[model samples]
Target: MASKLILLEGVPCTGKTSGARFVASQLRGWHKNVRLFTQESPTNPVDLMNYAFLTPEQYREFPEEDRVLFPVEETENPKGYMIPLTELHESLQKELESYRFYGCQPWEVERPLMLARWRAFAKEAMESDAVWVLDGMFFQNPVCEMMMWFDLPQAEIESFMSELADIIRPLEPLIIYLESDQIERRLREVADQHDYEWLDSLIAFHTGQSAKPNEVPDLEGCVLCLEARQLVEKKLMSKLGLDRVILKNAFTDWVEAYNFIRARVYEKTMGKPSTDK
Candidate 1:
């Protein structure tokens, strides 16, 4: 079979991580060569992982001249040079954070750089001979963040995603959408975690709430923005025409969601139900 990439995605607080992990576990249980790639997972497609981790301050601090590097290991692979990952991450952390630098404006630089990195990752993964179960896809990163960066219409965003789908089509993508009917309650559910500062920051940033008035966004505005973002995501992703398995409010209904996805994936892989789907 062709290499596969299963992407888990959903609104904030919708248990994307838990679901992705469980699905990957189930796939593995079935004796498949499935690899799970979450944001925190150390072993991931290097470019994608690095892009996800890039910070706003790091991006702003990155200098212009540090774009690409020339690695002279053999002294004559004239076409061979490295994009300095360490140097880039030192200033700008990941592709998502680049949105803070001015959204699509930074696309000119970020687009080529990240595209090259993703190609490297795709090539490497294809050769590694493992199916990828990614906790987040490009749609979640630069794409969702881009929605916030620009005043793009849903159609345009969909167009962008379609283009990306084509670029990574070699992996035979499968998107798993974990959705929720309880956005407000889910936010509170996530708030209950209350331990990690990163979680706090993520909540604040996603909700559009600034600590001080005029220092950040207003609460209501942020909530609406997030809703709009999720809505567009759901709509456009379906338009991508990739195989998809969607579960409603998977955050609260994990086991049901897990079983549903497990069965679907089995059927997809083997061309038959695992045990009466």
Candidate 2:
């Protein structure tokens, strides 16, 4: 089968969001139904980015006044109810955000939920003709949890990835890793583009998750942490043994990068290079 699941992955400021948009546009141009899910997308089928997961008992006990304000989804296999954080009032969300399944929970609790979600997603993808473009769900998000949050060993992380690979193998997923050789420069550029608060928050989140927070005190330390992360991610990508491509981008010429990515996606999905461009 041709690839229906296209994953664009990389660290911050690597143009993953732009790559995803380009890939989806290219697929749509080919008359294919394409769904582009960026990292911040609330309705991503595979990852629980901004949603709060609650047990059945907790769901029942949730305040009726607050619960009636928004839609709720119940999953049987995972045996939980999901409520979007955006739907809840600020005070209520603050109280429940820790229950989020992605970054807030430990890997042991998050692993099964991740696997189950992927299984369900793969089944649905098999039934549809639409192509799904995910910005960071495949490697980036999982890597953040395994490497930064949990500090798991490479072998253990590989085992977790292997299970996910098995579930999505039927979809013929393609992983496109966008990377820059100048990690520090890239991070600084991103930092320059954003406000001080954004950079401060980013450094805090990454450093605060570190085993030795004192070691990563500033941007220089954060750069080292990102360098380590990118290395691990690339290593894992090579081990996945799936159809994958690594694009070296400087983020200077996005048009050129888009052309290359579009061609690669064409080759993977249609078994030929794109002729349109």
Q: Estimate each model's TM-score.
A: 0.74, 0.88
Point out where model 1 deviates above 4 Å. 46-105, 196-200, 207-209, 212-217
Q: Tens digit of lDDT per residue, candidate 1, span 64-90?
A: 554333111121122222232333444
Clashing pairs in 2: none
The candidate scoring highest on lDDT is 2
Error in Å for residue 119 of model 2? 1.2
Residue-level lDDT tens digits of model 2 in 1-277: 7889999988877889878998998889888899889976767788877777877887777688866864677776567777788777888888787788776766765787778888999998989989989898888767778887899988999999988998999889899898877876776677677655666666665656333322335776667777888898888888878888888863878777777787889988887767865
Computed on alpha carbons, the lDDT of every model, listed in order, comes to 0.60, 0.80
Q: What is the lDDT of residue 83 in candidate 1?
A: 30
